[model samples]
Target chain A: MKEYKLMKGNEAIAEAAIRAGADGYFGYPITPQSEVLEYLMAQKPHERTGMVVLQAESEIAAINMVYGAACTGKKVMTSSSSPGISLKQEGISYMAGSELPCVILNVIRGGPGLGTIQPSQGDYFQAVKGGGHGDYKLFVLAPSSVQEMADFAKLGFELAFKYRNPVLILADGIIGQMMEKVQFFDQQPRITDEEIIKKYPWTTTGKTPNRERNIITSLYLEAIVEEQHNRKLQEKFKRMEEDLMFEKIECDDADYILIAYGSVARICQKSMELARANGIKAGLLRPITLYPFPSKQISGLAGKVKGILTVEMNAGQMVEDVKLAVMGKTPVAFHGRMGGMIPSPEEIVSALKNKLIGG
Target chain B: MTEEIIIAGFGGQGVLSMGKILAYSGIMQEQEVSWMPSYGPEMRGGTANVTVILSDERISSPILSKFDTAIILNQQSMDKFESAVKAGGLLLYDPHGITKHPTRKDIQIYKIDASEEAAKMGNTKIFNMIVLGAYLKVKPIVKLENVIKGLQKSLPSRHHHLIPENETGIKVGLEMAEKIN
Candidate 1:
């Protein structure tokens, strides 16, 4: 029966990390994502809990530091915004190639240049389409509300460690600053660094006392060897495709299904309520996991619903995924407002009503 | 019916804090609520304001096309927000800082020296709380008990001690609103 007072998004992330059995945090300061560093620095998990927290020189160095810690079989994490995330792609690619477990939270912003400091879902393509190089994939988790922001950190960390892969937390500035009521876990995961080292005896920890030499490298001199390694990565990724997420809200008798995610999904929830009041059966299909893309769930909805409409904060990046999922069994359409703008409830209602009346 | 409420003023004038309190109170009293701010670059020294919504059902959007009510803390804020209040909606202005009163005689205006009165009560920053108190007097959207609970939950640790003063400001505001109309 333990409860915590209200918490800011960053503070919640810090607490969630400790609960998720993360061994360390290696990060640098970046706008909109600095609070994550601030939380770990203030608490200094190294002193009390034996967890390491170090601020690196740059995003690249920080992510590389994460790579080093993770290579040693430690559960580690780092955070950055759009610009800094762009810088960490090389390190992320390396980690993915080496099969290391970690988490990365990207509090995205307006992009390309040193855009504004406000929230923007512009990093959707970069996050999903391999921002980091090579033929590796990252498990991406997008949280829209402050409540989800706190809870998903635990899920992200656990999933990453389970699969021995990296998980990305795609959040925005609004979700960062906004405070909300969240329940926290008290039974902390008491994991020791010695135990991780014992389990991962093959880790390259520099001349072990009693073990064969271990070398962690992504480069393979022979093409056949590298192709074999890539085939292994692909096989593991295909297994993850079955573990997709789909949230159905008031869709039992839905005349139309609204597909969206993150904060935009919260907006669509309200739109569904209003549309229903006016006798338009509107429901929601929120993909909590963007990368493992829940195609089967949407495929299941083809005959049960009439139409599928996508509402997004970007130019319908996820809408394309929805289209692939439904595959012309039902007409799939898109309505969106991009570049730091949130489409309102009235606009979504109008869109749904228009489609419901066969507009 | 859906309604949007905007209260704006200087940072220390309690505009942002009270806007949140009123929004939470609206939620407790079983209405849809949203609290938005004009943050980012305009955080310090510049004007701060919040938009609050109260509806019977799910709130579709938090943006404001027009407000059902407006509470002005300063002359500048009054001039800026007066145009956005919906027709026949209530407009409350504090004469303590606002020089240019709202012009429309069609809309209801409650002119009170809330800051001066709060300063007389030992703090001038409660001007926004006074406006919120007066707002509750006019709109009657939520109960007094709910508003008090919301304040207790929202007030940061540093400002928790001023709860009594906030309640006094609310009382004075309600009294002023009753007389000014």
Candidate 2:
């Protein structure tokens, strides 16, 4: 039987990680997301599932620990807020370059620097556009509700291993702190090393004297070899783009559309209803995966709607993608509230009217 | 039916918890509920607030600018949230810490001396329950029985012993709440 419980998003993610049979969770504490680590510690999941939950000295250290565990072909995860995620970029880049499978959660707060601890989608460009150096991409999932927060934790691990790449849960402070009903899925036991070896024969789990030694490193200093490696990564990125995920609300025969993700998407949902009630034909296109952005979906809506309004908690990041997707087929406008402030539904409605509807 | 509410007060005054209880009550009645709180530095001894929504259908946004009801517990919250109430909406406040009462004429304002009443009952911790009871009296969005069931769901088992006193506080609030406007 499925059991439902009212839980905070951060806590839900923590429980989901344990239930997903994650081998290790290494994270540092940060506001608006500390509950992930706090809940793990309180639950003592290590005793129950034999999962290692470690509080690293810093976000950098935590990501490195994840890299170490992931090298063994074990499912591992790390979580932090915006600033901490920035600190983990170097490690994340390394993990991506090595093609290590891991999951990362960034319960984002407002920032250009050490900004407010309030929720913001300011990290959109950093997350989807790749904050780390070199040519690499993370399979980023944007969860709008607490239920998705839990579900995505499991889904992220699945996708991570499937692609042999790092997966990111790009959530905002709103979803991290908000409380809602969540139904946990059935528990999955941690995959054994033998099973992992069969799936990923190129893992560094000690030589079995059967095949060539597996070397996991991003350093292909040779020019021709480096080009081949870069090309491979690009191919993976292209394949990732094919995995576009999105949700459309009232898009059929709508004149105006809003493109949004994460918490902003939920707000746009309300704004759509308000606009429809006011006799304005409005719809919403919510991108669930930020990196593999629902560009094709947005393109389909471009031909149907008069204009696309991209609403976010950041200044203007994802709007660029929306514009690229629409490709001048439809007018694209951007509205946002940066630095820890969330745009209210009424504000979004007004923006839709003024910018998209030409009111 | 949908009820969008904002509950605001001091950090330790159970403002957020009150909102959680109401959300739980809505869930008990098989309604959709979302509880979003104002987090960060403002949570440390300063004014804290939560936006709660209960609807028969799906809740679109947890973030709302205007509210059907504003449950104010202190002067700062009263000042900040009074204008946020929709016209003909309900604004309920406790008279304990509020110096400047709500002056909005379009909305219905009510005052419940919950702090004084809870103090009189010898346990000021029930202050929020009293205020919640008064809000329910004004607009019974959820049944009182469901609210008690919600209290059970929101409170940990260790604190279950206090439900009887909380019920009493709600009863007192139901009787004492007076509409000021």
Candidate 3:
């Protein structure tokens, strides 16, 4: 029988990737999330699980390596923090344009520049809004806990291959550095031949697959053909928007709702309690899927609540969506802390009392 | 309801180990739990911290802002988190390390000499467990049976021999904290 052990979040993500039937890991190390690379070095997946772990020359090289492996119809993954993820974006855009299925993990750190190695949710916009180029979405899964770190990828890789697209595990330094219980198990290969053939019958492997040669190219001779592809990507995005998940806490009775996601949810929860204690009727709404964005849930709460106040680690990535969902029916406000400084519960309460409640 | 707690202290004081026990017992009580330690640079420093969030609900964020309670092994920790405690929050301090009681009268303060208590038990390392035991005595969030199973889950397979000392430490703190209350 498999056993349970306390593992740091980065290590858990690495181990989970292995068990999810990933054929290879290509990554470059950066702070806070360095343990992800370090754990792969220790697990020695190459010798044990028939998995290949490559230390690429840089983030660009690593993501392109993922593109190469995914072309072979293998489950390949690459991981980096914010700055490194920024470097990988060009390759990610290329992967998306070519419809090459792969997975990327961004254990986010503070940013704009080579920000501090501490945790930050600054990359929300980057992950959801196509950081690299040309209208694409990385079916992003924002996991707030270590158990989710262990559990999210098996589903992520499956979805990547299903849609023939890239999937991202968006986590923060706090989730990366913290340790929690993980249950280990062996599972079937994540990418099956039948599944690949169902979509990409023209996978680039040893010749013998299809009669004619197949070259995956993102370039289009005419702008009209390129516009067609862009419209298709927009349709996929709309489909994703319809299927999103979020955690709703006490929103039915709340006149003022606290909107936050990722690590910021923890601070928001405590703030909600304090707000309620201070005679402000507040609750919390946390979206698990950042890109799909739980807009429908927020839309439902629009008429029920007086307002929605979005809290985030960055200036305001999610607040824009809160505004879109509320549609100016109820006021949508924002409170934020950046550069690795976490906002205290008192600060959040102050924002609520001063903004949502007082108004 | 089960709560997830994160207790952070320096390496010598057993923050990781205490967090393990909290998580182990938390699972045994049929609660969803995670015991996360401060890894990387923080672990090597003069201070350490862990965040444990035990909840009846499916936990969304492993990070914690206000814990239902906090156990501070040192005075610096108290200063670091004194403002984090909510009104009616519980503070457990080792009298030897932190002497300044919180100014707020709304919270419950349990002052114990965990180091001296561990000395009485003939083991200095169990000072962490003494504070842990007092936590169980005061909070009673997880059942005693779950705490035992949690020990089995946390300790290495070969270190099963040390389980007895760990239990004694918890029992001592429980007995002592019960007397104080």
Q: Model 1, A1-359: lDDT tens per residue? A: 45434455666787788767678898888767688889888877777577788898989899999989887777789988889999999999988888888899998876667776666777888888788778888888888666677778888877787777888998876666554445677646656657766776756666677777887878888999999999998898777775566578887788799987776787788788778888888888888888888888889988788898998767778778788889889888788776566677778878766754566
In candidate 3, position A209 carries an lDDT of 50
Of models 1 and 3, which has the larger DockQ? 3
TM-score of 2: 0.98
Better of 2 and 3 by DockQ: 2
Model 1 chain B: worst 10 consecutive residues (lDDT sum): B57-66
Error of 2 at A237 (Å): 1.3
Index of the highest-lDDT prediction:
2
Tens digit per residue, CA lDDT, model 3, B1-181:
6464547556788987798788878777666776655554556667888877676766645655777677777777787766666677777777675577556576777776888878876799888888888988888888877888888877878988888888888888897763222
- Cα displacement (Å) at residue B49, model 1: 3.4
Q: Candidate order by lDDT, highest to lowest?
A: 2, 3, 1
Pairs that clash in candidate 3: B3-B54, B4-B52, B4-B53, B4-B54, B5-B52, B6-B51, B6-B52, B8-B49, B8-B50
Question: What lDDT tens digits, residue by residue, belong to model 2 across residues B53-170?
Answer: 9999988899998999999888888878899999999998988867887888898889898988888889999999899989999998999899899999989899999999989888
TM-score of predicted chain B versus true chain B for each candidate: 0.89, 0.97, 0.91
Question: Candidate 3 chain B: minimum summed lDDT over ten consecutive residues — where?
Answer: B1-10
| lDDT, candidate 2, A1-359, per-residue tens | 46467789999999999999999999999998999999999999878899999999999999999998899899999999999999999999999999999999999998978998999999988898878998888999999999999999999999998888999999999999999878899889988888988988978989777788889998998999999998999899889876678898889979999889999999999999998999988888889999888888888779877888999898899999888888999899999999998899999989988886775
Q: Candidate 3 - CAPRI tier? A: acceptable
The CAPRI category of model 1 is acceptable
Per-candidate TM-score against the hidden true structure: 0.86, 0.98, 0.86
What lDDT does candidate 3 reach at residue B91?
75
